[model samples]
Target: MAVVSAEPVKAMKEGQILVTGAAGFIGFHVAQHLLSSGREVVGLDSVNNYYDPSLKQARIDVLKQQPKFSFVKADLANRETTKSLFAKHRFPAVIHLAAQAGVRYSLENPHAYADANIEGFLNVLEGCRHHGCGHLLFASSSSVYGANTRLPFSVQDNVDHPISLYAASKKANELMAHAYSHLYRIPCTGLRFFTVYGPWGRPDMAIFIFAKAILEGKPIRLFNHGNMRRDFTYVDDVVEAIARLIDRPPQGNPAWSGDNPDPASSAAPWKIYNIGNNRPEELEHVVALLEKEFGRPAIKEMLPMQPGDVLATYADIEDLARDVGFRPATTIEDGIARFSKWFREYQN
Candidate 1:
């Protein structure tokens, strides 16, 4: 694999940075971090009802107070609107985080996946392609490791066997991005995130759902009979990774060869990295932490594993650490405590 450049890929000073899906969980945090660092940011989102529009609105409302942050409510699937957005701002760098994001949901609503994750991403790529983007970072998911029983999935691993449409769409994004980068020399980086959870997390996620169920004294379903593990990365850690990576775009590997191509890097300026906690915790252990934080016992309901679900997910983040000079160190105990505090407050 080619070594990533240590130097920053400098963005144009004239235009504001673009963060798609800024109303969503990770995007919101990324935009906030960029704003705090004094970068003018244009946050775009459809504010779709994937989970709850009110929660999305709450995030947008908070960002509205920041002087350096501007919000644009538009669907990336709308090509004209997306085209106009690019023509208007001519963004120097884009953090594309918006997507139709649910594995189980994709089985029922595959069109949504096609519309958002596929079509929406193409629009973002078009914008970056035409507007002279300095760097383009987009979200991929650890779910792409589907059916692969590897213990600490690495970027070099082949992910051609995604079990769900959601994962397939993300894999497609990586391929699409590689094509754009190869053709246009666009510096593209794909981030494969693990199970991200924290304050302002999506309600559909296990942590949030389990917390809500436990609070209401309802049964929290344990998939695969409570025999599953996940690299539950905290959202703050994810944001920090993005902040560090924003400036360090990949310089194409001159040593790369097509005879034995690496999955994580290419001769073009395209790279993929897994940003995860690197610590896989049992689902039961996470439940125990939540129980301790809430001072209540959870009603456990062991159930069969749902379709389009994996038994475990662990990330190999050595590449990320070596390239970015950081690693995720937050313990699940600390993360759960903080999340519990915020969940309690948000409930009121």
Candidate 2:
């Protein structure tokens, strides 16, 4: 369920909520959802040319219309700038979403991951630590599951063997957050997001790329020879999950034991949740849905498995449901149809 209809589980904390990467796909939706619920939001973005600057600007332009929304354009990698941002705002809760995303891109440009994901994340932690944030919720990735072959990846799964630099960076964020939470007592929650797709999605993502190719009568590349599967969670579902979790910060488990430590929770105010569809859908099936929605046939190009890419990703959202009382429920078919409608209008 979207936040538009669902009542907020907890009232937002006083003062403006700081949402980094507000121009980005998921961040934009998160910011929008918060603003819709009568909350003041400070949206920040570097507006880099990761995909298309215009698309990011378009998202910002929409957010600008909200009287309660304020926009800031700054690079998170810059320590002084990020510090200044936190000092200026003194945000009660910080939703750190800005990062150098994409597993494949990390292979070509390893430095970017270090700059944005690692260095930038550290800056966020320092800010939250010194500035007194009530809760720090940051985006992690299912890619952190690396070599683990477990179906329906759980938050408690050991994620030490990340295959890609991007995944490693995300894992690093989780560790960094946990340490801060343990040492400084800042409440932190890490969200391991699966394949997030919807309106205003990244141009580099499979659904966006395939949508363009299918409409233009071009062949769509299916990595892993069209056999890959993903827990495709819609953007609204993700925003809903985030909206619900904002007020409910983690209170460290008293039962947590160092002798048999649980990877998902800590003795400190730290926790992790896998926010995904909890149902894996095949790559072929996703394309079929797109074709059905757009009323077009796709030309297929099967390719061997790419480096730093997993064969499948399924989310074990039991922890999220138990704790937050929510799980991503949008089916791939429904998500594709909604995406196709938006793509048509956006393309025009």
Candidate 3:
């Protein structure tokens, strides 16, 4: 629900936790953080061709170093495989993050979104529902705010129109989760993450693209006439928020009413929150920060707005702050510096 409430929670001391997309940017960070804190983690990833398999492998390499970490290589879309994986490890908590992620890509290949986001998520939800999963935290995206002219997007917003299939698929995930929560009384939490950037971030995102272009002395595309804003939440802050959330499973909202119901709340044990920096940054300003961090100017190439791209994204993380006692406080200067360092290192 959108209602603000909380309680302190200790980390899971025993029982295996399933982390889908463990080879991904945020998923890798989340898995490592859990293993480092003495939690046993079982990672599942399909190792698809959406990006370089090498990068995914590198993340797996890091995770495999932890003694408490185990992994299975398989696609989540296959119901049999997903069921087998769940049966093998009766995880008390499941963090579902694996999916075909990318907006522009979705235009060319809509089937991937349907297969991965929709079908895969349905499989994950079923696994949780049947396995007695205590908590299910899944990744949604700020892109779900497609076509909405809202500033500082809140979880309470009505998101009906999604410009891209990717956004639509993610939106479908939220709806599917809510239905599962209502029908099965499963505890589900959806986090609509803003522009998350840091070390090991996805190569498809603007931060990675801009940084690579600027460093290579190539022209970086400036869409929407360089008039764009995004709330770039750092990876560390996002991981911290997720860590805090895993232990606090949602309870049915007592104040929920059917007469004039809110989309963000339910009488069932379901919840959603915006995980973001709570601040917006202009496109020009972001480029400038990269230029400063890299000590080189980006060769600018102005262009019209992309088909599925939004003009801006601003997250109102009030519920996140109130519930987790945590907020995305990473400054651009520091965040960019960290990213720049990682980029340079990864290249070498």
Candidate 4:
């Protein structure tokens, strides 16, 4: 494992930093961490009614408490607003996490994915390029693995046949980021995050839905006949990996050659890594663990897998550990317990 130079992958310090989707779970947590570190951050969001505006507002309310934190209510898909944001504030480092998430939702309403993920991402890239941001750290997803069928998904893996539109959109992001990195020489790193669960997780995620159904004694649908596996990563761990990566922006790979190019690294200043718990857990075992923590057995309703689904998703985090010397260590039991505790506190 090579440590990304301790030279402290420095970015623009004087210019203000912009964080898109700061009201979302991962974005909110990252923004709070940055604010706590004394960074002057401008958080942006549309406050859409995608999930629950109140939950997003609750996150915004907490961020507003920080003197250094400023909030802006706007949509990322709005090109005018995105352009104006860059013009108004010079951002050195742009962290783009705003997107139309959810794999299944893409099948139901793909227009949302195009509007928010593709069109919205282009607006953000335009802003970064025009503003001359030093480095851009954007959130990618483990779903990009698609039909790769490889255990411990690696960034170096060839991700060509994406099964879902949402996956295709994310894969497109990596290509889009690389093109900019080569053309503009902007240091960019894309994080392929595994299943992130914890306090403030999205209501659409399996953890939240499963926990709710189990608590209410409702039949929880076990997708893939309860044979699914996921590298369930904790949110705090995900945020920590981003924090470590913030200081380790990729530089041009001088050794890169067209003869045998690596998919993960490029001649341009771009790189990607998989952030996961490094251990895949069975779906039913996770349910059992939650049942133990909540003291309620789930009503088993075994069902066939849903569309745009995969049998398993495991992350190969060797590159992350080698670079950052850190990996997600929270076990499913502990992680689920944390979520269960938050559920009890919030739902009660």
Higher-ranked by lDDT: 3 or 4: 3
Query: Which pairs, if any, clash in model 4?
Result: 1-322
Which of the two, 1 or 3, has more TM-score? 1
User: In model 1, what lDDT does residue 273 have?
Assistant: 92
Q: Please identify which of the two predictions, 1 or 3, would achieve the higher lDDT against the true structure.
A: 1
- Provide the global lDDT of candidate 1 against the true structure: 0.93
**TM-score for all models, in order of appearance:** 0.98, 0.96, 0.97, 0.97
lDDT of 3 by residue, 204-322 (tens): 88999999998899999899889999999999999999999898888868888899777677888888889999999998998998999889989999999899999989999888888
lDDT of 2 at 246: 91
Candidate 3: where is the Cα deviation over 4 Å? 1-13
List, residue by residue over 310-346, the lDDT tens digit for candidate 2.
9999999988787668878987888998998999999
**Model 2 lDDT on a 0 to 1 scale:** 0.91
lDDT of 4: 0.87
Ranking by lDDT: 1, 2, 3, 4
Instruction: Report, for all candidates in order, the number of backbone clashes.
Output: 0, 0, 0, 1
**Residue 73 of candidate 2: its Cα lDDT?**
98
Please report how far candidate 3 places residue 33 from its true position, in Å: 0.8
Which window of ten consecutive residues has the lowest lDDT sum in model 2?
A: 1-10
Residue-level lDDT tens digits of model 4 in 125-226: 999889878778998899898998967788778999899999999999999999998998878888898989999889889899899998888998888789
